[model samples]
Target: MGFGSYDESEQDNQEYDTDFEDEDGLDAEENAHEGDIEYEFTASNDELLDRLEDIKDNQNT
Candidate 1:
């Protein structure tokens, strides 16, 4: 009558162990590099406008 058969007694004797020390080490390494990279666009507004004009001129030609 059901889609599938599931036995609950099979899982009554199983043990699951999870360790967090390894995960904590990985998180610490990731946090250390959080401040290492500086994310910023160094291009000025005038420089960007000039590049856009150059592209437009090329497309027209």
Candidate 2:
């Protein structure tokens, strides 16, 4: 056994308790979501571009 050498028989066996009885306390069936998402944007392309330009211009000041 030198600097970085390790004996195989010296290491202990590791066992983990992988049993997580609903971690975060939310059941899979209860957290299930079914819905239709709709997004409505009131700003036009020109307006959005203008706002973005304003943001960039303000960042320089």
Candidate whose TM-score is highest: 2
Q: Write the per-residue lDDT of candidate 2 for residues 2-50, one digit (tens) a residue.
A: 9999987767665677777857466778778799889899999999999
- List the pairs of residues colliding in candidate 1: none
TM-score computed on alpha carbons, candidate 2: 0.41
* Candidate 2 deviation (Cα RMSD): 5.9
Residue-level lDDT tens digits of model 1 in 6-51: 6778789887766657655556555565447667889999999999
For model 1 the TM-score comes to: 0.36
Candidate 1 segments whose C-alpha is farther than 4 A from its true place: 1-39
Clashing pairs in 2: none
User: Where does model 2 exceed 4 Å of error?
Assistant: 1-34
